[model samples]
Target: MGLFSRKKEIMVGNICPKCNMEFSEPQRTLRHIEKAHKSKKKFECNSCG
Candidate 1:
């Protein structure tokens, strides 16, 4: 192996639904989604027109 040679990084984690960000840990991904994409309302309500 050369001095500058490096091993390839393997991504083994969950991906965010909203964004395509990868996380090594499931908990971290969940936390990031909650904090980054937190909705103002607890639930979304739809009304019939």
Candidate 2:
């Protein structure tokens, strides 16, 4: 793509009002807010750490 030829921003769902994070699905966006911003860490790895 050229410099002037920009890509389009597709909105599959709503953007997060709190952090301005874009998500394709509404459920996924909600989950992201809860996990990342709401201090709900539920998907931690034991071997990776």
Candidate 3:
């Protein structure tokens, strides 16, 4: 019945390897690692003639 539909709750079991944080979705966990744990590298351009 559309009137009495129950949504299943997802359990959070995904853990971040860097921070050990729990996330419900895998995507959120990956995002957290990229933002907090992983460091961003800057690229430098050199011109040679």
Candidate 4:
């Protein structure tokens, strides 16, 4: 292994483009999405806009 190298993923939670909500784990957020919210819209970065 070296610097600036790709690593294995842990299947973390999905990123909300609309809001800056980040989840360290997916299970918690997945449940929240399934229960609290139904469908979510994708958002893009304003800076990248």
Candidates in order, TM-scores: namely 0.53, 0.47, 0.49, 0.32
Report the candidate with higher TM-score, 1 versus 4. 1
Per TM-score, the best of the predicted structures is 1
Using TM-score, rank the candidates from best to worst.
1, 3, 2, 4
Position 35, candidate 2: lDDT: 74
lDDT (tens digit, per residue) of candidate 2 on 1-49: 5879865643436688778889878878867766777755667799986
Better of 3 and 4 by lDDT: 3
TM-score of 3: 0.49
Query: Where is model 3 more than 4 Å wrong at Cα?
Result: 1-13, 40-49
- Residue 9 lDDT in model 2? 47
Relative to the true structure, how large is the alpha-carbon lDDT of every model? 0.76, 0.72, 0.70, 0.59
Kindly report which residue pairs in candidate 2 clash with one another.
none
Per-residue CA lDDT of model 3 for 1-49, tens digit only, reads 5898786554334898767889888878867776787575465457731
Task: Name model 2 segments beyond 4 Å from true.
Answer: 1-13, 39-49
**Model 1 lDDT tens row, 1-49:** 5999886654435898788899888878877877898878566658732
* lDDT (C-alpha) at residue 44 in model 3: 48
Error of 1 at 16 (Å): 0.1
RMSD of each: 12.8, 10.0, 10.0, 10.9
lDDT (Cα, 0-100) at 4 in candidate 3: 88
Model 4's alpha-carbon lDDT is: 0.59
